[model samples]
Target: MHAVLKLSKYLKPYKHFAVLAPILMILEVAMDLVQPTIMQKIIDDGIVMNNTLYIVGMFIVMIACAIIGWLGGAGCNFFSSKAAVNFAADIRADLYETITYFSNSNKDKFTLGKLITNLTNDVEMLQRALNMLLKVFVRGPFMFIGAVLVVFFTARDLFPILFFVVPVLIICLYVFIKLSITLFRKVQEAIDGVNTRVQENLSGIRVIKAFNRMRHQVKQFTGVNEELTKRNMTADQVIAALMPITQFVVNIGIVLALMLGVVKVEAGANEIGVIVAFINYLMMIMNGLMSSSNVLIQIARAIPSAERVVVVLEEQPDITNAENPVKKEILGDVNFEHVSFSYNKQVEPVLKDISFEAKAGSTVGIIGMTGSGKSTLIKLLARLMDVDEGTIYIDGFPIQQYDIETLRNAMAFAPQKATLFSTTIEENLKYGKSDATKEEIKEALVASNAIEFVEKLDKKEQHELTQGATNLSGGQKQRLAMSRALIRKPKILVLDDTTSAVDSITEKMIQKNMKELKGSTKFIVSSKISSIQHANLILVLEDGRIVAKGTHEELLKTSEHYREIVATQVEKGGILHE
Candidate 1:
């Protein structure tokens, strides 16, 4: 209920319609309540007296009330739907915007499957629940209360039936709601599990096929699907008993009312018309009770979804701009001052007391075995994740002091895994520099060695790329990623093993071309020593600590790790000396 209140702001814009919808529903309930009295009047006054004119007039009044009820229902439906659709749109847009600004660390807090379910499934559930709330919730209460009042004023002797039946129905509804709430939450969790399985299988289908794990994957999916089905059935089973019990209670009340009415009529104490009208009101009350119970059950089911949405909406971005942030051109002079970082505080640090400096226009090389914090070090340089201890500076200014976009926009980073979207090659290149010209694109392609393969395609730069660049080979994808970084002409360029997939010859060509790039300071993280041997500075890292830092020739003599790496990759062959 508190979560519902939090989201009430989404209804603020539609407040007029929101207010109007309930008012119209009240009118519909009024029309419904009037029909029973009209029926009683037609039967007792017109039919008993054989008054044709009176019968006609009563029939005309009933018809007008029916039309009014119909118009009111139609208006309520329109406003409810309008409010629901607009409310959902607003929430969905905000969720996506919040996700867009999420820090890498914040993103790790929620799974991709869970987030998708919140955006699509949970939001959809809220939309439907809001519609029901506006329509059924309002109508049920007004109709139930109105019917009760009318029946009491018309036939006071039978009001005890309402007392007995309504209480039973209320008790049954309470127990049903309590049981269903827990079950509904489990049902939603089961849905997340199913979605998680589907998300993973779809994303990793190629690997599943390559490893011949189709049957195993199917078995895993079957387990999640079965859990979802079982939970849904459990929720349904708990509430399934509700309808029959409610009907039995209402039927008993109606029978008692009819029996008492018959006794009163035998004593010539009641008219048949009034008794019939009382029974009609009782039925209306029964329908209202049942409808209200269904609406409450729907509300119970949607509560989990509402909480999920609120979780995202309430989340503040872990990384945000500081007040009065400095926005300036970075000179590419980067320094790490005793910087240390960990993905989580409970775990061992990924980078430990790491400190280094790269002058403007110098190439700083990083080499380590897998999990030596090579990629983590590069990410810290780009401010992707803030350091847990110490500080990093660009051009002698603290990285945090600068505006985030200003800091990132001045640097170009090609990650270890090359990712390309579903679009034309030209569009992909322009992602780094939106207004890149043909000549600049050509220059970037030449520098990255992507121009050769791109030229072989019929469309040249216009060639379309499949999702993740599956249409291109590994080397082609790497070169294109590199080209994207290079086209920006950034002051700082960080390539995290971007040449791993390319052959030694192409790797040499890329390195040579990058050396020709005049102003950009480059940080290259690579396993192959040959790739970084010519850098102005080379840092050998092991177990999250920098073990050696010097020019390639200086480290070759002073560091055993450098010597071993040189000895290992020397046979693979590139010139090792200046």
Candidate 2:
């Protein structure tokens, strides 16, 4: 409930609409309350006296009141809709912006499916609740209190009927609302489960097909879908029962009112017109209670949703720019002094006390077995994940001293997995350097050995790639990804096994073209010895430690591990010794 209240700040921009909606709804309620008194007058004064003119005059007044009430209700609906819709839109936009700033570690805390649900489903629930609150919340209490006061003053004997009816309805509302809230929370969790299952299946549809497990995936989806359906039915059943119970209580009250009215009329203590007006006010009171019940049901659903949205809204990104950050150009003189990191503290460190240096404009190659932290090492250098221990320096200053964007902008990182958007090839290249000219794009394509195939395409750079670049071959995707990085002509370039999909000859050609960026520092992480043999410095890693570091010829002479790696690759005809 507190979480829901916190979101009210989003309504500040729409305060005019928010304010007008309830005010108009109150006016409508006032108009509705006036009708019972007018009816009492038409019956007691006009009908009892047999005055047709008086009855006609009061009838015309009733018609005017109805028109004003209708206008008020319509205005309330219009204003409430505007305020709720804009409030939701602003919240949705802020949620997206917050997600974009989430660090890798922060992203790990939330699944893709759960985040989607928070942004769409949860926010929508709050929107609906706010809309109902503006209209029903204002109308219900005003109508209830107004009816009660009118009945008490004009028909004091009949007012005691409300004492019995109101308490019974209040008890039922409290019980139903409590039961529904717990069930609604479960329903929301079940929805999250369904979304997660669907997201996983869609993202991995290819893998499922390749493994011939389509039936298995279908079974899993069905289980979650059934769970969601069951939870929804359970929550709705509780709320559905509320309407019948409320109607039963009101019906009993109506019967009692009729019996008491007959007794009073026979005793000549009450006029028939007064009895008729009392019944009308009683119905109005019941209508007000029903409106309250409807709003409570919405609140039960919205409470859970508001909490979920607040979690995202209140989540502070683990990575943020320093208050007084240095936003300066980076020269890419890199140093890792006793750096160590682990994804989980309970697990063994992936990189342990790793100390190394790469001078500006140097090419350093890293070769290691699978899971030897080659990729993890470079991720630290880019500050995707901060080190658990020690500091990483760039240009003789700690990396944290620089603004995150400025530091990241100084380097271009082409990861092992090629990620490309569903856009034209030229637009994808422009992501690296938004203002890049056609000639610069062509140069990057040529350097990455992607020019030959891209030139052969009918539309060349204008050709549209499918999502994840699925339309292109693996090697082609890798080439385009490398080209995207190379287009930046960054001060530091880190290529993590970027050419593994290309042939050895093509890889060699790409490596040759890389020399054109002579002033940039480069770190190439690869499994192939041939890829790094010409590097100014080569690092051989094992068991999360740099066991050997030297030029290829120097390492081959002095390090047994380096010699064995070269020997194995040479025998397999995977390396071309220069």
Candidate 3:
């Protein structure tokens, strides 16, 4: 509940709407309260006296109150909806913005499916709760208190019936709300499970189809779906029971009032008109109590949602720019001094005692077996994840001294698994350098060997891509991803096996083209020795450590690990023994 209140700041912009909603709801409740009194007038002064004119006059007054009440209720709905919708929009925007800044380590704390649920389902739950709170919270108490006071003043004898009814209703509400809170939390967790299953299935649909595992996927989805349904039913059943219990208690109070009224009327202690009006007020009291119960139920459901949203909102990214960070043009002189890192401290470090240097305009190649920290090495240089121990320097100053944006902007990384958005080829390339000209776009496409296929498309560079570039071949997607990175033409270029999908001939062609960027320092990580054999300097990694370092020719003679790799690739006929 405290988490929910913390989000109240999102409502600041909509405070006017929030204020207007409750004010209108109060006016509607006041109008509703006037109707029972008017009914009393029509019955006693008009019907009992057989005066048609008096009855018509009071009936007209009731119609006018109904119109005013309708207006108030309508206005309340409009304003409340306005506030709630805008409040959700603002919170969602901030949530997304915060996620964009999250480090890889920060992202590890949340799964893709859970974050999606928090952004969509959880935020929606809070919006609906806020809407109900604005309208019902104001109307319920006012209606309940107004009816009680009216009954006391106009029909005192019937008021004692409420004393018994109200306490029973309050007790029932308290017990049901407590039970509901626990059930609703489980319901939300169940929703997260359903979302996670669906997301994983959809994202891996290709793999599932290739492996002929459709039936298996369906069985998995059905299990999660059933869990969600079961939880929803459990929570709803508890809420459903409350309405019946409330109705039963209200009906018992109505019977008591009726029985007591008959005695008073027969004794000539109260008029029949007064008894009729008292019954109407009793029903209003019942409605008011039901409304209050509804408000509390919404609060119960919203608390869990609010807590989930707050976790995201309050999460501080492990990586943030230093205060007064240096902003300078990166010269691409990179150094790592005994840097080491582990995704989880409980596990062995991914990269151990990594020390290396690459001067400006030089090419450094890293070749290692899978899981030898090849990709993690480049990610550290880009500051995607900070090293747990030791320091990394760029141009003599610690990388931490540079503004995070400045450091990242000066480097362009093409990851092993290419990621492209659902946009035109030109638009995707522009993501790297937003103001890149058409000529530069063409040059990058040519350099990455993507131009030939792209030119054949009906829309050419304007051709739209499906999400994740699923419409393109694996090699094509990698080429386009490389083009996006190349278009930036940064001081430092890190290709983390970006050419793995391309043919050997095309890979050589792309590497040859990369050499034309003489001003940029390049780091290439690949498994194929042939890919990095011509590099100015090469590092052979084993496990998480650099086992050997030298040119391909130097390492071939000096390092047995290098000789073994060369012998293997040579036997496979992938590379010649030069």
The most accurate candidate by TM-score is 3
Candidate 1 lDDT tens digits, 1-578: 77888888999998888888988998899999999999999999999989999999999999999999999999999999999999999999999999888888777788777888889989998889889989999999888999999988888888888889998888999999988778998988988898989999998999999999999999999999999999999999889999999989888988999999999989988888989999898888888988888889988998989988898888888877889988988889999999999998999999999999899999999998899999999888777889999999898888888899999899998876888989999999999899999999999999999998999999999999987788998889999999999999999999999988998788888989988998999999999887888899999999999999999879978999888888877766645433
Candidate 2 wrong stretches, greater than 4 Å: 45-51, 571-573
* Clashing residue pairs in candidate 2 (N, C-alpha, C atoms within 3 angstroms): none
* TM-score rank order: 3, 2, 1
- Report the poorest 10 consecutive residues by lDDT, candidate 1: 569-578
lDDT (10s digit) by residue, model 2, range 260-316: 989998999988899889889988888898898889888888999999888988999
> Per-residue lDDT of 373-410 in model 3, one digit per residue for the tens?
98888888878888899999999989878899899899
* Candidate 3 displacement at residue 344 in angstroms: 1.1
Give the residue spans of candidate 1 off by over 4 A. Answer: 458-464, 572-578
lDDT of 3: 0.91
TM-scores of all models?
0.94, 0.94, 0.98
